[model samples]
Target: MAKLLALFAAGPLAALAAEPATVAPLTNSGIAGQLVQLLLGLGLVIGLIFLLAWLMRRVQQIGPRGGQVIKLVASQSLGPRDRLVLVQVGTEQILLGLTPGQITPLHVLKEPVPLADAEVATPEFAQRLMELLGKDQKDKP
Candidate 1:
C-alpha cells in the first residue's frame, strides 16, 4: 500500500522512498555543445523547407498534359499595380487589362498577331540614342 502511495506521489521516488535521493544529475557539456546542437536543428528545418518547395515545383511541372497551353505573349505596365497583357489561347489572341483586384477583357484580335522577335533585341531608347548621336552601331570602334 505504501509503494502504491509512493507511485502516486512521485515516479523515481517510488523505487526507494526511505533512503536519501540518489538520482544522477544531468551533465551540461557547455555552451559550444548547445550552440552546435541548436545550429544543426535549425539547418535541418531550413533544409526540409527547401526540399519540400523543390518537390512541389517538380510535381507541378508533371501536371495536366505537360503544361499550360495559354501563353503570355506580352505584358505592359500601366501603373504600379496595373498592367495590360496580351495572351494567346489556342488559335485566338486576347488583350486583357489587369488591375489590383480585377481582370478585364479589353479586346480580342480577329486574326492571330505574331509576336515580333526583333522587339526584344532592340529597345526604343537605344535606337533613339543612336539616331540623335548620328552613329550606326556597325561603325563602332
Candidate 2:
C-alpha cells in the first residue's frame, strides 16, 4: 500500500519534470490585441442583452393581436386571489370566476348583446349596478 501511494505521487512528479517550460514574453501589441478582443466580446454580450430586453418590451406592448375574438369587458376582485371577469366572445358575454388554481364559468348570457350598444369600454357605476341587478332578477323566478 505504501509502494502504491509512492508510485502514484511519483507518476505526477515525473510527468511534471518531463514537460518542457516554454514561456512566451507578453508584447504590448499582443496585449492590445487581446484587450480589443475582450472588449468586443463584452460589447457583443451587452448589446445582445439590450436587444432581448427591447424585443420583450415590444412583444408585451403588441399583446395577443392576431384575430383576437375574446375581449375583456370588466373584472372585479372578490378577494386577494379571486376575481369575477366579464368577457365578450363575438356577441355573447360570459361571467368567469377566476381563482389562483382554476378558472370557472359562472354564467353565460342567453341573449347576445351588441358590442356597439353595450357601452362596455366606459360603463358608469350606476349603469353597471343596475345591469347586474337586472341580470340577477332575470335569473330568479
Candidate 3:
C-alpha cells in the first residue's frame, strides 16, 4: 500500500519536472493585438445584426400576398397610453379602442369611406390654424 502511494506521488512529480524550461512572457503589444482582434470581431457581429435588421425592414415594406388589405384611416389619442383608431380592412371600416394591454373593436361603419375622400375630409385643425396665423403675421409685416 505504501509503495502504491509513493508511485502515485512520484508520477505527478515526474510530470511537473518534465515541464518546459522557458515560457514566453506576455507583452503589451500581444495584449493590444488580441484586444484589437476581439473588438474587430465584436464590430463585425454588430454590423451583421444591423444589416439583418435593415434587410428585414426592407422586406416588410414590400408587403404580403394580398397587398395592403388593412389601412389606418385615422387615430385619436384618448390618454397617455390609450387611443381610438379607425382602420379600413378591405371594404369595411372599423373603429378600434386601443389600450396598453388590449385592443377592442368598438364599431363598424355600414358604408365604407374611400381613402382619398377620407384624406380630403380630415384636415389638421392645428396645422390650419398655424398657417392662418403665419399668413396674418406676414400680411402685417
Candidate 4:
C-alpha cells in the first residue's frame, strides 16, 4: 500500500518534471500595472479603516444621547476635587455636590433652569482674555 501511494504521487511528479516549464518574461507595462494594482489595494484598505473609524465615532456619539434618562445640565467646580453638578431626571432637576470622599444631595429645583441660563457666568480665563483684547483694540492707533 505504501509503495502504491508513493508510485501514484511520483507519477504526477515525474510528468510535471518532464514537461517544459514556461516562464513569462516581465515587461514594463506588466510591472506598472502590478504597481498600480498594489497602490489601489493599499488605498482601499486605508479608506476602509477611515470609514470604520468614522462609523465608530458616529455610533458612539449617537449611542449615549438616545439612551440617557438622566442628563447633566450644568457643572461647576467648587474646589480642586469638589464639584456641583445639576442633573435633569425626567422633568426634575437635582443639584448634587461631589467630593473625593462622597457624593451629597444639595437641592431639588422647583422650576427647571433653562440650559442657556446655566452658562451665563463666563470663565475667568475667557473674561481676562476679553479684557486684554479690548485693551489692545483701544491702544491701536
Candidate 5:
C-alpha cells in the first residue's frame, strides 16, 4: 500500500515536470476584439438608462400643476349618469368625469370662490350637479 501511494505521487510530479511551457503567436486583433466588446456593453447600459429617464420626464409632464387655471370647454354624460368634463390647461386638454358627490376645481372664473363656501354648501351644489347630469344624459341618446 505504501509503495502504491509513493508511485501515485511520483507519477503526477513526473508528468508536470515533462510538460514544457509554450507561447502562442501574438495576434493584434485580440486587443481590438476585447475593446469593441467593452464599448458595446457600456453603450447598451447608458442607452437603457437614458431611455428610462426620458420616460419618467414624459410621465411627470402629463399631470396638472399648481397655480395653473384650467378652463372647461364642454362636458358630456355617459351611461348610468357618469359625467365627463373637458378642461383646457396650459398646452394640454384634460377630461374629468364626475359622479354624484365628487370634488372638482372651478378654476376658469373671473372671480375665485373660497374653498370654505364650497365645503359649507354641498347639498345645493350637488343638486345642481345632479340636474346637469340628468339633462346631459337625456340630451344624448
Candidate 6:
C-alpha cells in the first residue's frame, strides 16, 4: 500500500499538477527567415549567372566572326561594264570584279600590306570606299 502511494505521488499527473507546461523554443522564427535567405541566395546566384551569359553574348555579337575576315584596300573602274575592287585579307591581297550580273576574282597579290604601313585612324582610301558604299545606298532607288 505504501509503495502504491509512492508510485501515485511520483506520477506524471502530480508533476503536471505542480507546474504549468513550459513552452518549447521559438525555433528560428518559424523557418521564414531561413526560407527567405535561401530564396534570396538562389536568386542572386542565378541572376549573376544570367548576367554573365548576356555579357558574353553581347561581346560576341560586337566582334567579328571567327577565323579570318577579308578587307578591301583599293578598287578601280574598268571599262563601262566592269568594276574592280582590291582586297587584302590577312596574308594575301586579291582583286575582285563585278560585271553586270556576274562576279569574278581577277588576281591574288603575292605581298600583303603590313598593318603598320597604313594608318587606321586616317585611311583616305578606306574613307573613299566607305563614301562609295554610302553612295550605292542612294543609287538603289
Per-residue lDDT tens digits for candidate 5, residues 1-141, read 999999998999999889896878877778889999999999999999999999999998888656567655566777676777766665555556687888465344443322332233346676688687775323434
TM-score for candidate 3, residues paired by index: 0.56
Model 1: lowest-lDDT 10 consecutive positions: 115-124
Which predicted model would earn the best TM-score?
3
lDDT of each: 0.87, 0.83, 0.85, 0.88, 0.70, 0.78
In candidate 4, what are the lDDT values of residues 37-65, reduced to their tens digit? 99999999999999999999998897667
User: How many clashes (backbone atoms < 3 Å, residues ≥3 apart in a chain or on different chains) does model 3 have?
Assistant: 0
Per-model TM values vs. the true structure: 0.56, 0.50, 0.56, 0.45, 0.34, 0.34
Candidate 1: misplaced stretches above 4 Å?
1-24, 64-67, 117-141
**Weakest lDDT window of 10 consecutive positions for candidate 4:** 132-141
Model 3, runs deviating above 4 Å: 14-23, 27-39, 58-66, 114-141
User: When superposed on Cα atoms, how far off is each prediction in RMSD?
Assistant: 7.8, 12.8, 7.4, 7.2, 18.9, 15.3
lDDT of 6 at 44: 100
lDDT string for model 3 (1-141, tens) is 999999998998898899977888877678789999999999999999999999999998786845879989988999999999999988899999999999999999998765675224425785578687775323432
For candidate 2, what is the lDDT? 0.83
lDDT leaderboard ranking: 4, 1, 3, 2, 6, 5
Residue-level lDDT tens digits of model 1 in 1-141: 999887788976655766786879778779999999999999999999999999999997787754678988989999999999999998899999999899999999998888785535458799789878998666755
